[model samples]
Target: MSPDGMFLVTFSIKNTSKVVGREVAQVYISDLQSLLPRPVKELKGFVKVVLQGGETKSVKIDLNHEALSFYNDGQMSWVAEKGKFEILLAASSEDIRLKNKTESSSTITWTRL
Candidate 1:
């Protein structure tokens, strides 16, 4: 980890189906709170990539302190709090494959060194 505790977000896309075609994968990284009843932040940009069928593509998202930090004890820490994080990796921004849902929703807890 860096002094700021920033890290890279890496993901892979695999063609599970046997069908062959040009697949374009659009990956997104956003805060979980935005999907809540009362959203605190706005949607960010897209991390786009194109891949072929049966091919696996890797994507990296640079996460800084501001992007991963949360208010803790009157200060922000380099910790992605224990809550569901929204990661959208799909064919399109609005179009998502139910069976191929790439977004992972889970709590991210980090240990401070």
Candidate 2:
């Protein structure tokens, strides 16, 4: 991922059953440490994919500046502090499948990644 928070999240899914199935791949961002109160994980982007039995497909989610930010009461705008962040891939909020880390070299402000 880039410091601008422009990242392409790609993952592959396979349907092993005999019937078609649909899955929503959700992307969430987590602030490991924050000065303000925030959710453990925030929904950023998602993709809905349907696959036939035994079929496999790839899903992609585009993450940008907005995805990496949090509402700041001090600045009255969105902000992403410079540090480590976590990216979570899940079927739902309670069902996280994968996790990865990213970092921002500088504090990312509103309208910027």
Candidate 3:
């Protein structure tokens, strides 16, 4: 992430099989301490890739503050609190392949945008 709260997540995916296959890489975000009720993980980004036999490719998913924010009912706005967050890469929600940490050092709130 840059100093301005933007992320450029890069990872590689490979097709280990001997035949061509299709796959989708999913990105999920988790807020470690949300004041409001929220799911443990939320799907934020994804990319579909078709690889030839024994092929490998690199994928990137960009995440901004808005992607990590949750809606605050009382405030009637989206809020991204300052704290820890988890960035996950998965083939599906049931199959998380990688886990890592990121943080927001400053709080931000906005409505409809």
The best candidate in terms of TM-score: 3
lDDT by residue (18-44, candidate 2, tens digit) is 999999889999988777888999998
Q: Residue 109 error for model 1, in Å?
A: 21
**lDDT per model vs. reference:** 0.47, 0.84, 0.89
Worst 10 residues of 1 by lDDT: 98-107
What would the TM-score be for candidate 3 when compared with the true structure?
0.94
TM-score of 2: 0.90
Model 3, global lDDT:
0.89
Tens-digit lDDT string for candidate 1 (15-106): 66556545555544455543224233323334655555667766666654344334343333334443334555556666753221122233
Candidate 1 regions with alpha-carbon error over 4 angstroms = 17-45, 69-113
Off by over 4 Å in 2: 111-113
Candidate 3 error regions (>4 Å) = none
Give the lowest summed-lDDT range of ten residues in model 2. 104-113
Query: How accurate locally is residue 25 in candidate 2, as Cα lDDT from 0 to 100?
Result: 89
